[model samples]
Target: MLDGLTLDQMRVFVAVANSGSFRAGAGKVARVQSAVSHAIANLEAELGIALFDRSGHRPVLTPEGRALLANARDILLRVDAMRARARGLGEGVEPELSLVIDTLFPLEQVGAALTEMRAEYPSVAIRLSIEPLGGPVAGLLEQRCQLAVTVGEDFRDPRLELRALSAVPVVTVVAAGHPLARQAEGRTLAISDLADHLQIVLTDPTPLSEGRDFGVISPQTCRVNTQETKLALIRAGLGWGRLPLWEVERHLAEKQLVRLASHALGRSGLLVSESYLAHRIDAPLGPAARAFAQSLMQLSGPRSP
Candidate 1:
């Protein structure tokens, strides 16, 4: 059996659980399929227990696999902190900046700022990528990116600093034709009333895709990878799920969608996310990163006092 796993192995482990296939996971992580296969095999060996069971082409997580997921998350978080600090050393006065974010945030404000910034600093550029929660954090830690803006509290790295910018409202929604849409017009529901409901969820690790995290109250959940699908499912009256108020505003105004019910089901708790911009404390920022962070702050505007 292999010994301790490295940062690379932990990443591969996450990809497999996500993609559900070696080839697909490899493509996402930018590795060859065989390399992904080898990584998972070696990872299982190191842990002294089979993480996944070969049920066919796809692997199923054994009981042991579920236990290791948390550990892997911890290991990756530490490695990510080290990487950010290491990259800081290389960013001399001004270096290229990588900006990663959760798509659910109000991007319109930042989008305008970015356009203005490009004309102002043509020489400085930003590398941008969007993923669910862990991937963005991983990018910063892998030195693949410099800093990240994440939703939720998965970023518990002590080496970094986190800030709460705004408290966005989270509410359950469904397409107009759905059953929940009717409930919104009539009355609110109790937690136990949703036992037979199918909740449409955007299951990406990012905040925009966090409908499943409320599973304690929603036992019947369907995981969806894309925004279009979430809308489609809700429209088909197949499921109901939560979404950020920022994104749902226009739709609600247009009467395209409605809230699930007036009441909470299964002790549902709303997710109040603190937008965090994390960087290595030991490493000073390059001119580009600093300037960009400033621009981001300016674009984010101010929270109500």
Candidate 2:
């Protein structure tokens, strides 16, 4: 008997329960009141359960109907999603978008872009990875990710296409109580002044950038893989390091971290790190991937020098 139960019957059942009347449910499903009532009656008979109580002026869901309403709604929603996914595939939309982003890129911008992407392509799944230094590029080269956003202006790889996104300011900072912070109070510190202090630096996990160090002036150093760990260690007064200004702006404003002023930091103790959007030259982006890329570009605005 349950094998005879149909989706139309479930739909009519849910519609009547939600609208609280057979006539309203019929209007909701574009069927007449008699047909709606008949579908509900068939559903109830098949399950041998009283789905509605018609003892009152308007129909009301019975305890059994209430118990199963959620399951019925879930099934309808999944079917809708499956249909959307099928339509998207037929339209050449990618089933999934895999993106790897550099740790230096502002997370807020990434979140905003992804939010837009989700609204525009709900059927496309997203796989996101946050990596440091060479990791994003490596993910692209290895075909582990379909797209990448990374820092650095120098991508000489012939197999990849790179477009400038924006420039993120990198600032040298230390805990408010660190010795370096105290040293930079009166006057600008010289390059030699940092030689004695332990510098915290981010290391690339991939061999693509193995043994290569960026902006390492201090002889004594602590190496970390993630930016958060480096920031935490620096906040603890264990060391000083260069971090993205966007990441530490609040700390700097709250007096938790002090920006270092030094002649060694060329250009007012600020370094402009250029970021780029990258992908393989061999593989073009699909509809969903292209939409996501456009979203990122639009949200990021004009590239900063």
| Alpha-carbon lDDT, every model | 0.68, 0.85
lDDT for position 58 in model 2: 93
Error of 1 at 42 (Å): 37
Residue 215 displacement in candidate 1 (angstroms): 4.7
* Candidate 1 residue lDDT tens string, 216-302: 356788878765577677766787776766777788788887766534531232445567666655455776676667777766743
lDDT of 2 by residue, 1-305 (tens): 47998889988988988888999999999998999988998888998999889999998888998999988887766665566445555667678999999998998898888888889889989899999888899999899998999997544465567888888888899999999898989778788998789999998878877657788999999999899999999999999999988899999999999988787886657888778889876565777787778888887853332
What lDDT score goes with residue 269 in model 1?
Answer: 25
Best of the candidates, lDDT: 2
Clashes of 2: 0
TM-score for candidate 2, please give it: 0.68
How high is the lDDT of residue 299 in model 1? 67
Residue 72 lDDT in candidate 1: 82
Query: After best superposition, candidate 1 residue 170: deviation in angstroms?
Result: 2.0
